[model samples]
Target chain A: MTKKKLIYIILFLAPFAFIFLSLFVGRYPLSVPEVARILWGKLIFSAWGLQDISTTIVWDIRLPRAILGALVGGSLAVSGAAFQGLFRNPLVSSGILGVSSGAGFGAALAILLFNTTSYIYIFAFCFGGMAVLFSFLIGKIYNTTPTIMLVLGGVIVSSVFSALISFAKYVADPYNQLPAITFWLMGSLASARYQDIMVAGVPMLLGIAGLIAVRWRINILSMGDREAHTLGLNTALSKGIVVICATLATAGAVCVSGIIGWVGLVIPHIGRMLVGNDNKILIPTSLALGACFLILVDNLGRVISGSEIPLGILTALVGGPFFVYLLKKTKGGGW
Target chain B: MPLVEVSNAGFGYNGRAIFKNINLEVREGEVFCIVGPNGCGKTTFLDCLLGLLKLDQGDILLGGRNIKTIRPPDVAKVLAYVPQSHQKTFPYTVMEIVLMGRASYTGIFSSPSPADISIAEEALAIVGLQEYRNRPYTQLSGGEGQLVMIARALAQKTPVIIMDEPTAHLDFKHELTVLETMVQLVRNTGKSVIMATHFPNHAFYFENNDVPTSVALMDKLTFSVIGRPGEVLSEKNLKSLYRINARVVSYQLDHNTEVKQIIPISTLYSKESERVN
Candidate 1:
């Protein structure tokens, strides 16, 4: 049919194909029939005609990893698109509100204090949400969340939390907790168990749903607060809703996946190039692209070397240069 | 009743009074022009009427209802605003930009429907920019961008449109196009326009079109004069407000037509010999 419909179909289908491919693409390569048998057996009933190791490889490890990758990638990218539109700045991402740094510190601190497994997720999520709240409250110092002030608030909170994270590292046990914190900060989906997925899924889905619901309003909001107000938009309510949704999505993602960077920042730009800047299409497009991009990147992490490459390192190492290329190709335009 | 009525309305910020004790009215099929120096509260006055800001001393009413009582969405259905400048950050297509005008009617979560799309297309047709519908808005010139913005306001389907410095930063042709579009829209749709502008000639332009034009000059932070463009826009008023001696000249264009324009002669900062005679 139309070009846009074609793009949507491609975007919507790419993730499923990539995820299925990922099921058989690890240290233990399973054949197509084996992977299918494992999936069918595990999903339908008992693991009939499937080996235990094969089923665990397909259902337990790769499935959760791919699904978690999809959720976090979609959430972060969508949050970036929403924040970019709301702030009317192309360079801004959800992390501009200090969510990533805050979550990093929280995870680090949780590791420093408690040996409990779930404490990392809890601390990361709360601190991520709290960091954004602190940024938002700082933005409201002048009784308004003016764009500049909000960005400044994010910068302040980010630096402060960054310093705190550094301090936590210094006092941390170098032999035990230091490596844990460092590995977490470098970011990986090696630990994408069902527990992490279950913990992050609700808020991630909630934020994505909210952003989609308010997607059209982001167009009006990109006109700036005064213009939006004149257009009869309840900007205060709309802006608050956007901030909360973005915060939720961001914090939820950072909690499970640690600090996966650049996907949120770069994926929206790719979506914009494909769909133009209409948030209506750009948002969903970013979602699909982000899901696909992260799955692909995670695949590289699994297969590129003998050991798994950290997602945070891979994303920045690759995406940073690619972002610069996009910036140049766009010639400082299309923002 | 007037579409918008501002009586005894005053607004200020940070312990400074911007404007006070203002009374104004806008009727259907009328062009109400507010001209003043920069930051003379022309935009502030417009914001008050649009219910974006509350009147510090009094109230503004829309079609006999107090403006404060009407919610923003309802007020949007009544009046649309065209700001002085639009950011080019997003490369929104002209059609997408125009479709955003339907946002007032669309639910917060919903997309624009087919009916809204047709309405937006109709707005584009009215502005004669239908061919530019799919072009990136950021790629358009300042004048074309302003037309697209005007088309957006038209798409809102409001009874009145509020514009702040709509003709600013436009070439000669685009300025005339904007003024002509305003006159044509008022004539065709019976929609009133409340425009704040720096150019006194815009009032004369409307008057020349036989549109009922009322020019209000905000001098000394108040309405110094309000009446027909030719009668009220004098050299004395221009000097008092802009601190410049300006000539309000009438040029004979044809056998039966005269064009009125304002030409700045000298500023107070000019050398004595070069000062206005």
Candidate 2:
């Protein structure tokens, strides 16, 4: 491997390893060899009768949570990377397109208006994603420039949805539905199961794969629509495909994990800073780094205190200030 | 036969008609120069040829086929264009920007092939920018950037190259260098060259060199003077075309003893009546 490739691999893998080990090590310290043996036994042999509680902890609880963390992280990061390229602005994220607000409104509507269970969260996410997609399509039909008008349309859509969410909160049975809405917005991996992973994993993986396949084209498209079209690329079609893929990926993640903040916005920027702006490298590296960053943050949330903090809080706590610092540094120098 | 033919082409933006009843033909292996004042629809005409703008009336035919029938990729294979200037916002290497010319040929998912690299290198060599290939394009001088744009057009390997004010940003020496390279491309490769420029002197220079060139001077909508060097570059023709009296003066170079021409517009008008007296 090239030195740069090796460095990125190490940087990407080390955090994953640390998070994996930390998951089993805190309050119930299992040796690396022991954890390895437990994982191997569970995989290669049907050894349900293993002696150590380490097997149960790693297999049943932490493993599903870790996988879920990776899925959510990878989805957010890849989506963020694609959006940044689409807008030609590194600051653009999933939230800019009203995906989060739409998802939040969907979830809130399900909980408050319909009094639905967590099972309806996925529906909410899909509805939210579709809302944003519809807005974008309408804007395009009217010949709106994707940069300014599309973003403004998203903001408008998000505000209307936000008011709906507030209205739903007001009408909701405060004791029953309000807490569920709040908890979903805070986001967590505490309730993750293997089934939850299965629900979210398919779309996330598929979206990331599609983005990777078209990453080079995305880079070319970043030059602006006129240049891209002159180069014989169907700029409109390519952009539509990318936006849909990113939306599906993010929607799947938000459905399962609620509105986890910062990973989508910050991970791609971090990936760019680490490996440079070539999307060929940035896409995959963002996926790996995002998975690692979130897994590490989620694990920290698990063990940092007597009680588990929300994954959303942990990421915001870490990514928020770091983002500010990056902003300050890049103030004089344009990113 | 003409390689590109625009018959009675009319275009407008947002219901504002800019030009109407425009007719032009660009033949192969010849340099066609389009000269007009600012905003005479020169760039708009080029845009129409490239299918960047849709024409409200008439047809544009390439190789006797309507442009609408040809796919964008096929059109790209036949015609390459270099804009007046490109905004290099990102930090792409000169080679990387040049390599983007192969986008039409490469597969959607595949990297550029070795043949693409070779073509790009050859283009860079043609523009005298071989050594600067690895340098960041944004860091290059204005002249070098202009050359890089030409190199990109050359890399397309198209039969016809269209440039809108290719030398607009270059100094005098670089302007000459770019024009010389363009003329060489037409002469050696048998590629047709179409360029738009404000400088009438360039058209005179090309014509005086016995190069295969045609000059078209746009005066107003549907009014133009088109002919060979001396036929269309007379003082009366230029005065009518530019709405200013101008003297076309010829001078012999010291070293080469070649005839050079200059169009002095501002001062020549005052001297016209004096010379008449």
Predicted model with the maximum DockQ: 1
Candidate 1 fraction of reference contacts recovered: 0.73
- What is the Cα-based TM-score of model 2? 0.89
Write candidate 2's Cα lDDT for B70-97 as tens digits. Answer: 8776777778888877866555578877
Off by over 4 Å in 2: A8-19, A25-27, A47-52, A114-118, A143-148, A320-335, B208-210, B254-264, B267-277
**Candidate 1 chain A — worst ten consecutive residues by lDDT sum?**
A326-335
Tens-place lDDT digits, model 1, residues A210-328? 99999999999998988788777999899999999989998998899889989988899988877789999899998898888888788889998999999988887777787688778
Please give, as one word, the docking class of candidate 1: medium
Fnat: each model in turn: 0.73, 0.23
How well does candidate 2 score on lDDT at residue B63? 90
Scored by Cα lDDT, where does model 2 land? 0.79
Report residue A138 deviation for candidate 1 (angstroms). 0.6
